[model samples]
Target: MSRMWLCAVSLAILCALSLPTFGQTFSRILFDTDMESDCDDAACLAMLHALADRGEIELLGTMISAKFPWSGPCADAINTYYGRPDLPIGVPKGKAGIQQGSKYAEQVAKQFPHDCPLYDDAPDATRLYRQLLAAQPDGSVTILTVGDLTNLRYLIESEADEISPLTGQQLVKKKVAHWVCMGSRYPADLDPGKWGNFKPDAESTVKAIEAWPTKITFTGGGKFAELISTGKRLKELPQDNPVRRVYELYFGGNVKDRHSADQIAVMVAARGTGHPWKLVTQGHNHIFPNGTHQWEVETDNPRHQYISALADGVDPQEVIDSFNELMLHQPK
Candidate 1:
């Protein structure tokens, strides 16, 4: 071929490679969890699977944030049920203590095997976070934290040197377009107990918010997950469904009411729906001995961003309906 013809062919190939694929629109998400806290994590996992089935999001990793011996296998089993056993699961290296009065502890102990096998060969929490973030294009990733912020803190601290001049928060601000977390309260609502999955390490949470470089949107309080009740909605699925089975075993056919905060948090983080909740502009104030953290709205506070409007009213029925549709339509 002539030199001009060869150059033209190379240009054509380069253009083809540069064009984005059909699947590129979906956002990549890292689902950080502390499973033993509540059933909301399980519900959140179900929501993630539903979205993946609909091609709305790509699940990068599911790292275990706190040590709940049974959580590893429980997460693996749930992932296996969702048909995405390849997803990585990470547990805190060394930590102990189940969140107070965990109802799932006995269930997890009875159900999850002692020799809990990991579902995939994921690196430790820090490395996994770094790998996923580095692999994605800048400003394209969204880190969704539904559990404790341990893994996120690790990622921020470990990768700080790589971003230079950009602190972990700054890097997250620049590279990660959004950080959606499920913690805190609605303004001066000093009700920490009401914030279901946020008690494990309130101090860490305070530090994380203080250190966070970008604005964060939170979804929780007395009103967030108050819509979904477990009973009939969970029973709607066949026993074979992994999530349904876990639900059955844990609640024993009596799934009258349960905490849905984590699930609602996941949905808001993943889909950006629900009521317009307020954002804590001043970041975290003192975390009291009772677990509640304080916040004050500031005109130009750089530490945090509070979302006050309830984008939509709480609709557990709608959530359940969406979940059913996703499961029914999932690819064979």
Candidate 2:
């Protein structure tokens, strides 16, 4: 080829590479949860809104796992608080097994027919997963699981080929790039005695860890939850504060209560500001008879990734501080 022609071809290739296709920042996030199970999930949903207010993340959808009976109402309450009652909210199709009669329940009901509609009739989580995953660009979505993994397991097993067209590993490599899970025990460091959320659906939790395409980060234990408290932060702001309203409603005048691990996990996934996460080891799929899920390092799993550190520990702190600051002021 002539020298001029070769130069022109090279320049064309460079320009094509430089052109932007999609402007999505930090990919997309899908928050899968059993919200009615705990106040932390509600708090986390509030924190997510705070981050969104700062233009740091994009929330794709919210799915309710089978762990909570009133998942739909809880999801609606959260959506209503965030001024996104139109966002997709999916609930489990079958029985939710657990009963609800707590402060969380009363708080969730306050939103009632307005923000929290009686949407026990929406599409199942698996169907919602298919639609969201299919519509998102390749490798641009992160499934943040803060509750039981039943919804994710259903998505993987039922819609495996459709949602993840590539091989189990390849599909994860291309479509769902990352999973931030808030379950499991941290061995000797943070024991289960410190946190009560990991006790639900241990079997499904193990299945999720095992089946997840290795690119998953497990943020478990009570360390992250203990470091930050929304009670004092919430009170620092007025009742109209978006973050405070969610916190106060869910917490119901008790602000010192520790939030959910799922909440912390989502914050880390979205911002990782104030909480320091240590990537101790890779996760496996082992399940105990008691339904307690456990994870160990595996050298063979190429599709897995446990967060060793969060941008030199700057991300977690920044996230916590930002949440505090946002809650101090009213949403613009």
* Least well predicted 10-residue stretch by lDDT in candidate 1: 94-103
lDDT tens string, model 1, 123-157? 47765566566667788777788878766665565
**CA-lDDT, candidates in order:** 0.60, 0.59
- Per-candidate Cα RMSD to the true structure, in Å, reads 6.9, 6.4
Error of 1 at 229 (Å): 3.9
- Cα deviation in Å at residue 53, candidate 2? 2.7
Clashes of 1: 15
Candidate 2, residues 1-332: lDDT per residue as tens digits?
89999999999998766442222245478988766656667667776666666566778888877434456676666566667777787765644223333346445555443343344556777777777777778888888877776677666655355545544434454678778877654542233444343455555555556667646766754555555544466666655443455456565565554544555576567753234555554444345644454444554355544442344546555646755664453445
**Which candidate ranks first by lDDT, i.e. highest?**
1
| TM-score: model 2 vs. ground truth | 0.74
